[model samples]
Target: MADGILRRQIQLAAANLSEAIDGADGFQNTHQSQHCESAKFSIEQVVFILEKIHIMWESVLPRSIYRRSMFHVLGPVFSRITKDMLLIDDMAAEETLQLQGLIHLALENLSSLFLSLVENDDDEKFLDHHTWVQLDESIPSLKKFRKLAELLDMSLKSITAAWESGELANCGFTSSEMRNFIKAIFADSPLRKECLGWIVATPA
Candidate 1:
């Protein structure tokens, strides 16, 4: 029963996180006038889910269990999502480094949290505070990435961690290959212009 609830909560968290991240303006200079409505809609969806979640858990689990474990487990992940979206949407060029740093840190933290949960031998046990994200790729179902889209829907931080930890890459590739891959993924993305400008500015 607890496991089921945990899974459900994980899914809801991932969905809200995905919507928030996806709906956020990609450009640093996007004005609120352009983004206000989407932002409001995304936040409202998350709040609605959260309110229902509070009610559902209140009914299903003991008060002590909800207070002790769910709060701890959900809070960090929730905080990470909020920070990630805000950072990703920041338009100020002066804060680029700060944004990147937040991106790196949040992803690592979320990854660690996920690894702890997945590797936990006991489904009912709560983890300690400082356990780091493990690089283990043998985690089944997760290995094939069959669950990646859904997992991303639930947790991009862990997804980023998994990517940075090399669960997604098959072999070493040259920088050219990496560049080509990036171009393919972001060809129509906002990053496309940046990539083109870099290429144009580079020496032959």
Candidate 2:
């Protein structure tokens, strides 16, 4: 079925993105650009897959279901992912750190939404059982997104740690300076609130 194939593609893309993020962790400043390019490639793949999945969901689900609040919530999140992918190339290291945080938060929200759908049966009464089953088939990919979120968080923390220990001197800022700089930038940006909202908001 087309739905099954799309789900598999999403899973594969998430797996590839996770692997690329992991690979990025092993590089220093000298090789960081290569890893960044690799990670960017994977991210673009994920964005493409997600865009396809969004289109598929819209096509396959009933209009009523597609218009549901829960389904609508994902639209902005997917848009953010695509936008972030486009901007990744232009971001400085500190900007990329903030972007990673936003990505992790967005993925966490998506994962929570999927988990809620998987665990709750109340939707079965409104949506037909067949449609519910179709949605359920994508749960594995949702779980993969959660795992990817955790990995992204870990990668960001590792990079911060390296900076703290002066291990990233070649990248220019000392640990304390980078920390202050991030705080100042994020403090002024509305994105900080948006990312926090994603992290703390309940699934619809």
Candidate 3:
């Protein structure tokens, strides 16, 4: 029963996070009015969600629940961010770089906290527990999401090279995802068309 309750709490947290990202929650309206950019607004909302998760890790939840809860809560968030924010059309290069930095730092901090690494002014101190390692390794989405951030800023040649080498496929990216990413990030050109064809030809 305790496990069920904890799982439900996490599910609710995930739902809330999704709502916030979708601008269903109140934060989006106020902030979007000022920024007038939906993608940037969504990234900020994700940062806010991460901050709340950090507090829960610090005080409310037991260490034992951290791995399970984080995986449950953050997995879909990775997908949401890719589909809604990262895969958007006509995103400015400058804005993409800035948002990439923001999310990369936020994710790094979360990863450090999950590993029970003590963050200080100078550097982080590692803890002697393997549970966090298990959590990190178990969630394939986390790895893909970070890679997606890198791919967002990569050149077409580099991106296609990574795809050809099976790096993106090994990172858990679907052909559909590659198609969408290419369409969003690259303008219509012979090279872009060729990349899209490659994605279509590849098997899942």
Candidate whose TM-score is highest: 3
Instruction: For model 1, state the Cα shift of residue 19 in Å.
Output: 2.9
Model 1, TM vs. native:
0.36
lDDT of 1 by residue, 86-204 (tens): 33422333233333333344334344334433335655644344322222232222222222222223232343343345543432222343234334223245555555444334313
Pairs of residues at least 3 apart in sequence or in different chains that clash in candidate 1: 14-153, 14-154, 28-91, 112-133
lDDT: worst 10-residue window of model 3 = 24-33
lDDT of 2 by residue, 1-204 (tens): 355764565556455545543443322221255655655454455445545555665566654554342343443334334333332323345444544554554453334334334335563433345544544344323323333233334443453444445444432323343334334334445654443343333211
> What value of lDDT does candidate 1 attain over all alpha carbons?
0.41
Query: Which TM-score value belongs to model 2?
Result: 0.29
Cα lDDT for residue 140, model 1? Answer: 27
Superior candidate under lDDT, 2 versus 3:
3
Model 3 lDDT per residue over 1-204, tens place: 277887777777787778767762221222233543554556567667766776766476665466556666777877676555444545555555655664575576565545542223435455334543444366667667778778868988787778878888888887877777778667799999987887677655
Candidate numbers, best lDDT first, in rank order: 3, 2, 1
- Candidate 2, after superposition: displacement of residue 101 in Å? 10
Off by over 4 Å in 3: 24-45, 48-54, 57-62, 108-112, 117-136
Candidate closest to the true structure, highest lDDT = 3
* Backbone clash tally (model 2): 0
